[model samples]
Target: MNSNNSVFGQTLAQVHSKFIIVQVLVVIFLCVNLLLIVTFFKNECFYTTTRYILFAVTLLSDSFLFLASDFIFIFNIFRVTMQVSLCSVSCIIVGLYLIVTPVTLTAMTLERYVAICMPLRHAELCSTHSSVHVILVIHGLSSVPYAVIFITFFASASLDFYYQYRTCSVEIFFLYKWQDHVKSAVFQFYFLIMCLIIMLCYFKIMKVARTASGDDKISSRKGLRTVTLHAFQLLLCLIQFWYPLITSSLIHIDFTDLQHVRFFCYIMFNLAPRCLSPLIYGLRDEMFLHALRRCLSCGLYETK
Candidate 1:
């Protein structure tokens, strides 16, 4: 019995240590993202109207993500009100922003595709006013489904206060019943459809890249690199953020079967995406890197 108690104590200490590390990493990442956003905006002379709009959307989405993560980290550190009330609102906001960022990314990808692949007709197709209108419509349309889900889930769950030293989550509504199967099927179908669309876009892009002549090679290669990196980042986010959550919601797995180490892994999976996104863009985009370098140089000169 004494040996078993010692082992249990050691396990709990390890879990606590892991949680603290995760929280620190999350804070560092959020700060870095903020700095990147500031640097991006400061260096721009006159951003295209569409690019400005997209940046605004990205900023809003990332800000919400940062806030949600920070709140979770704080709640984990301090045993705050464990009622799901605060978290429900945060979850809804995060969900809406989560959907918004991807929709913006898809629009940005299409914009790049059109600009590069159909340069002759780009002026007619993607004017500033048209781009603004399209962005507004996309934001409104993509957000509706998530808003509906949030409302439905909030109404379905009974509000009872509970205390626990962990971040709050929306109660998995379809964990055991037939509804679990239905939800999982619908989610998988949606993900599959999105994957199909992304793959189709990539195929066309590759085809265009292959046919481009000597002078176009450099630009084509750059664009392809950008798209490839963006796709990889999105893939990482989808796998890390959505996969486990969806699986847990779908499968009625026994808690006893889950290793405690998995809990830290799950937290890392969620936190890493947000931290990595700005880093990916900074590293991949020559324009962004140039601008960042210029800004840093100017700052150092001013300090001198």
Candidate 2:
């Protein structure tokens, strides 16, 4: 018993250390995002109340996930009951945010698509009022799957476990036989449909851009860059996060069987996208690059 207890203690210590590292990285990512938001708001060109609201919503959702994960990590240290509750709430919020963000991304893509591919219709179609309404509708649609998952999971009383150092996962739903098949099918279907929509929209935009002529060289380049950034984002999204989770689900393997590998992968996957996003935007967005330089120069001037 003493030997076993010592081994467990060592394992917990290692896991706790990893969790602390992830927390620190998450904080850094949030700070970067906050800076971007401030820079965005300060720029009059980018100031639209609708965009501000969307930014706020995304930040709030991301913060919830961060906080919830932090709580779970801290709670693990003491083996408290509250961890389970935090896990449930965190899972629901994270799941909802996951769904909502893709919709936002899709809308943002369409916004860029219109600005490049259909410049004449851009202002009329993507006015502030229209964008706000579209955002609301997108969020409403996204909430449906999360709501179903939350209700079903909670109602079934399957959220009782508070595993130490384990991140809350979608695979927890699969423990129930009915939820297992239902969620698997739903996820597969949704992923396929989303991929198809994204492909179709992108192809159409590219086709339109190719036919147009004149000083659209800049616009065409921007359009392609936006699509590439989004593609990279999607690649990271799938390979790092969704792919691992999906693999775990499809294999029907015991979570404990590959526990450490999954945890490490999750940490790397989640952190990579957050860090990569800012870098990609900085590289691809001339406006953002200009803003960054201006901010840096202003800071230097103030210091001097």
Candidate 3:
């Protein structure tokens, strides 16, 4: 009995140590994303446009998504019970952020297409005000489904005041119910359509990139690179968010059977984009890179 207890104690200590390390890594990644956003603030026209504003919104939403998910994660780790309504609202916000990201990327792709394929009309068509309104509309549209379902389902169903799982997602407490399945389907379908649109836009942009004017060639090449990055990023989002949800639904596989794999996928789906997007988007632009380099030279990033 003493030997068994000793082994159990050692195992518990190892698990606790791993948990703390994971938490620290989470905070560090979140901070790196924040730093990426900060680098965008500079004396340049890139930060002035509505397009860049929309890009910044994506960065902020990515960070906010991780913050919400990790907040629930930490609370659950500590066994902190929260009211059902509050948890619903918080998770809904996180869901909206996840949805808004791909929608924003779709908009960005469309903007690039117009700038490259319809150059004469690009200015009036892709104004800053219009971009802001599009983002607002995305937020409204993404929230509607979650808000409607949360109210509709919670009204009729019995639920505990405290969270039943670490994720604070309705699918956790609600299980394999209709609403849970429907919500996942809606998000997956939305991302699928967004992925198609992004791909189509990039295809047209690629054509324009090949046949370009002497003056337009540089800008065309830049657009080509940016859209290609967007396509890969969208594909990653599809794989991370859409595939797991769809595969799980279709196979009805026991996720618990592969605990480590599920957790790694979960962390990737939640946090990888937050770290990757800043680098992908920022580094793809020569101007942003020059600006970042200048900031580094001038000590804008100096430790104060």
Q: How many angstroms is residue 282 displaced in model 2 relative to the true structure, after the best TM-score fit?
A: 4.4
Residue-by-residue lDDT tens digits, candidate 1, 1-304: 9999998798768657866776677678667667667766786442554544565466557677767766755564443545455666676666666556656666666766776688798777777778778778767856664565555565555555322222565434322454444444544554565566566666767788898888676777666766676566556555533554555654566542343434544464455545545655665666666666767687674455
Q: Over the full model, what C-alpha lDDT does candidate 2 score relative to the true structure?
A: 0.62
Cα lDDT tens digits for candidate 2, 1-304: 9999998898778767777787788888778777666666667765453433444455555555556655554554444544555566766766666566555655666666777777798778877778678878877866776677667766776434544334446665444777755665655666666566667668877776687677686577667777666656655544432553556564766644455565565565544554555665544566666765666586673355
The alpha-carbon lDDT assigned to residue 284 of candidate 3 equals: 64
Superposed by TM-score, candidate 2 places the C-alpha of residue 169 at a distance from the truth, in angstroms, of 5.0
Overall lDDT per candidate, in order of appearance: 0.60, 0.62, 0.69
Better of 1 and 3 by TM-score: 3
lDDT of 1 at 154: 51
Clash counts for all predictions: 0, 0, 0
* Candidate 3 wrong stretches, greater than 4 Å: 1-21, 42-44, 77-81, 159-167, 173-176, 213-215, 243-258, 297-304
Instruction: Give per-residue CA lDDT, model 3, range 1-304, as digits (tens).
Output: 9999997787667557646866786788777666657767765576556567777888888878877877766665445767666777787877788677777777888888998899898888877777768888878866765675666566655655344434454554353366666766766677778878987987888788788878788888888888887777766665655544654554455533343454465566666655667666667666666666667667754443
TM-score of each: 0.78, 0.78, 0.81
